[model samples]
Target: MTASDDEKKMLRASLQSMTGALESVKMSKANTKPRVCLYEVIATARDGLLRRTKLSSDIRKEEGHRRDLNHAVKDANVNVKCKQQLAFNNQDPAQQDAIANDVENAKEEVITKQLEADAQKERVSSLYLERDDFNNALSRMLDATSIVMPFVNLGEIDDDMLQVGITAQSTFMQFCEDWERR
Candidate 1:
């Protein structure tokens, strides 16, 4: 189905918003230096990663919903066709009329299912695009953070510092794995 003007406008607006957010993240990462607090930088990057993860999850859900809708539409179409065939073959006039009505209803159901599937497909596509944009931005931020984090002076080494470093390393590894999975 063709997108309406309003739908197009909404899509454009969403894309623009994602683009702006990604640009902001990129700018922040680019401006990062060794003098910047590693914790704060990591926190910001972690937030972006979380957002990207959430968007990816949403995209997955939308894809599943779209698949279900497509199956429903296919089933509805098959039912309509089967009913139409039955209606034509029936010898009794009354039975034929009843079957014809059933076929009409099935046709209407197919139309409804098709519309729903189309809308769901559109949503899934939009979500995938948004997720990709966020993922790219997050990946850049993570890369920048990794490069700058090691150089940042965190004062004299202590047990607390060691623990923090270990935690950060673990989290970063998990983030990398998650990105790779996607």
Candidate 2:
């Protein structure tokens, strides 16, 4: 299901505030000339923020897995005593035993929990890898925009200018994109 009405209202309010702030920035006068499209700047900034958030989320997931595994081990260790006690509850060996069965169940539970934690850890690592790639791509884009924007301020908007001369920003973006693919 979707979010509740209250949640939607809160989100809308937040969005409105963000829009107002961005509009203010757009209207502000600047000493430095903006050479690239404003959209490019906004997009690059947003991408940077997204990459950072993804990287942080990956780290949190990895830490969460570690905590989960620790909890599972603790629970199993405590359950060990219970299982042993339950297994030998009967007064005689003549009766069918259950302590062994309880212990086996505990073992299975520990194994299951550990496996789940391991899966989460692997997922976290995968996210981190993607995060790194995105970060590199954003950095390259930022560099390109920095160089292009200044040229644009100088009334040089043609693609031919970029072709005639190699800017560090453009080169860096190309290098980053290539590396990210690998």
Q: Candidates' TM-scores?
A: 0.61, 0.54
| Residue 28 Cα positional deviation in candidate 1, in Å, after optimal superposition | 25
Alpha-carbon runs more than 4 Å astray in model 2: 1-38, 58-62, 85-96, 153-182
Question: Over the stretch 1-182, how does candidate 2's per-residue lDDT look in tens digits?
Answer: 89999999999999999999987776442312333333445464565676578678768868787787878877886897787776567666644255677788888887888787777777777777766776675666566666565666665456554432234344544654665576
lDDT of each: 0.72, 0.65
> Model 1, poorest ten-residue lDDT window?
154-163
User: Mind giving the per-residue lDDT tens digits that candidate 1 earns over 99-150?
Assistant: 9889999999999999999999888887777677656656665665565455
Question: Distance (Å) between predicted and true CA of 91, model 1?
Answer: 0.9
In TM-score terms, candidate 1 sits at: 0.61
Which one wins on TM-score?
1
Off by over 4 Å in 1: 1-36, 153-182
- Which candidate number has the best lDDT? 1
